[model samples]
Target: MPGPKSNLIDLEILDGMPDGIALVRVDGSIIHMNAALRHMCGVPDEPGEPLKLESLAVPDNIAQWRRFFTHAAEDGGPMSFDATISRASDKFTFYAEVSFHRKSLHGEPVIVATIRNMSRHRKIEEALRLEESRLEALLRLNQMTGEPINRICDFALEEAVRLTGSRIGYLAFYDEEQEKLTMHAWSAQGVKECRISNRTIEYPIKNTGLWGEAVRQRRPVITNDYNAPSPYKKGLPPGHVRLERHMNVPIMDDGRIVVVAGVGNKPEPYDIRDVRELVLLMEGMWRLLQRKQSEDQLKMSLAEKEVLLKEIHHRVKNNLQIVSSLISLQSEVATPENMTAAFKESQDRIRSMAMIHERLYRARDLAKVDFGEYLRNLTSYLKSSYQPRTAEVQIDVQNIMLDIDRAIPCGLIVNELVSNAFKYAFPDGRRGTLEISMRKDENGILLVVADDGPGLPPGIDVSNTPTLGLQLVHALVGQLDGELALHREKGARFEIRFK
Candidate 1:
């Protein structure tokens, strides 16, 4: 038991503490209270009578306080809890952290209670949680790349309404070419039950109301009281949802307002933080939309180029066919055997070049030709033109690819060498076999045209041969930057190697 002096010192210490301190009897009647406790309870400086602790508790919390006191006394242990307390005069409510303990005062048991206000700390925690949620929403928006613009806009609008605790949200895109704004996506929480039908809301942007003001100003617009009369006010359409608080942010691109985002009917007035969050979301969506548009344009450009290339190949092939036909006509009119043969050789060369373009027109990859298939087709044409009665042409070529630059010259070289073999090496229907082989190794391409018949005329110098065919072969070999060799042992063998 504390004596008079000890009790006075304890009262002084309790009064000096920051937390509200109160002493209550076992029945919950307040025996004594410090200045902090008196102020928290809204008690007058000079009370007419003692006040009960339960009186300071709001109606809903009175029973909870009674149960807490009973538990503290029976358990003989300190108890900590939280509750809302209200002042009786104005019914003002405040959250508090409270601790209770059974203690002996003047040989009688009493409950000592301490109260600490938690309103400020709770507000800070709530704000941090909200900021965290907004950051997560921003991250989700950034990850939606490559999606269609409409889908991205819808997601952004939905997230804006959800993050800002608004009932409805919409995103509109401006068509610069048409000089108009169109709503692309919208989300409404209660459209089914509301007076407004979502279908009726679709319309072009008009120069009226808050939305129009945002577009004209090209900045953010916020209104806490949308019902207030103003010069800019254009009354809402019939069956439209009533707007109490609203906000709109413009999405700018290339120094122009390309998109507008708006939200309305939030429980509380919109603040700068809400505007900032909505702007961030809209900006992210705009970037994604821009990227999707660029990808689509690139695809269209590539397709157009592909069509143009095919047309070019087709025209070139047709022109080369015309040149081949002219050569054929010239050969038919030539009287001299030598002049006719020269004209025929020129026709074969032109046809060989034309075949490359024909293959390119039909191929999926127009840049390179399937040289193996081209060689097979060329050999068939040469055999048909020369009419080799007894000699059979055999092809041993791998499936090799060459670009047009290399393929055209290579085709001419084959035409000249093979025609020479047919005319000179095997004469008077000489029965023999002609082998044509092409292969690619680490050393580069190797082409060999050989015949098993009488050898070349004795001492015929291939490097300085007078024959037009051999001279043409030499010139084409140099053009290909290739090494050429002539073998005249059994028949004629022409081999060329080029990188």
Candidate 2:
């Protein structure tokens, strides 16, 4: 007796409704019910034209429901509550969502109540929560893999004992070459703190014990019932009666077997998959430790090389000083003018080599020398070279260090420059002041050698000077890969920028 469109609307509403429905009067008398309510009440019959609300079977918390209904009937209008209900089969429990609403039906005040079964949904929620917990635990294991092996092994032993609800666990480190597995750590507080003075153990790896099998096969081995006939029975120590289960996993370092992490006295056997996962984590931690050890060894080797180089420089300095003393002694006994001049030249050569070693001794790096110190020493030697009894030479140096390759050529250039100043710049009883100064600027090394004597001979151009000293200076500057500027302001200023 319904039209097609009206029937379609009724079907849609019925399918969309979430829970059971019931109609009751203000006084709590049952009037009508829906299919969902019939299933929940576990009765198919209407029971004498709609049973009384209190007469119909309900949950033990029905008094709380009535109180909620009365409260909804007041000015607030509607209320909701949750409770657990038992099914008629007596095998299943359901979470019930109940709602009460005060409304008018057939122009009479009534209360609309609804209930929904939530047992299946609750199961799904619990499963999701458990999966999330497992994922978090796996993440913690991965983070532990980044630490050192000793720490990782310690954490693994603690986790294994805790997971199995056991009171004792120990880890044995396998010495592959020596065929030994020594107990390194134990869960018992007193045992771990005990000093292990006796380090060697006669652990035979070729035997059928759990530690030997794990190391030889590169896998994990478990003994669930150690009390029964077991391959590892002989490996147990004397008076060791409490161990009921055991598991051993191999730890690898750089793809090579390193240690066997054997756990004993477990409450029960661990799964094969769990043993494999823990071994894999231990392998990763061992790899990190191996890399750190290699890097430390490399740094130590480099430090030793530096020490050897410094010692070589120190020996060279001592040898050159002995050569300089020989040259000075030879020059003191020479009488002929030519012999004295030859001996003096020999002394100069030895002094040059001595300067190199002297600078090397004070340098932090043996491969280079301080350029400022070299220049000052060379100028002082040249001032003495002329045997000038009146004029005094002064040196103004700046801070700079040059590699040995550059220092040698630059030192020779300073020697020639100072020699020219003492020889020709001052002649005929004329006293002069020679200033040798150097500075480092953004451009490069700024070296100046000037004198307060008569300027270069009137007919000599600095660019085309025919002097041997000038020629040597030009060649040395070229070797430095630098440029030279000639200034005729006070005396002769040869300014160079050598990078």
Per-residue accuracy of model 2 over 104-188 as CA lDDT, tens digit each: 7546677777777777787687557644544454456557534666676676566555544455666776677777677666666
lDDT per residue (tens digit) for residues 142-175 in model 1: 7777666677777888888987889998788776
Q: Which residue runs of candidate 1 sit more than 4 Å off their true CA positions?
A: 1-8, 31-63, 85-95, 175-179, 197-206, 299-312, 315-499
RMSD of each: 18.2, 21.3
Q: Best by lDDT, which number?
A: 1
lDDT of 2: 0.65
lDDT per prediction?
0.80, 0.65
How big is the positional error of residue 463 in model 2, measured in Å on the Cα after superposition? 64
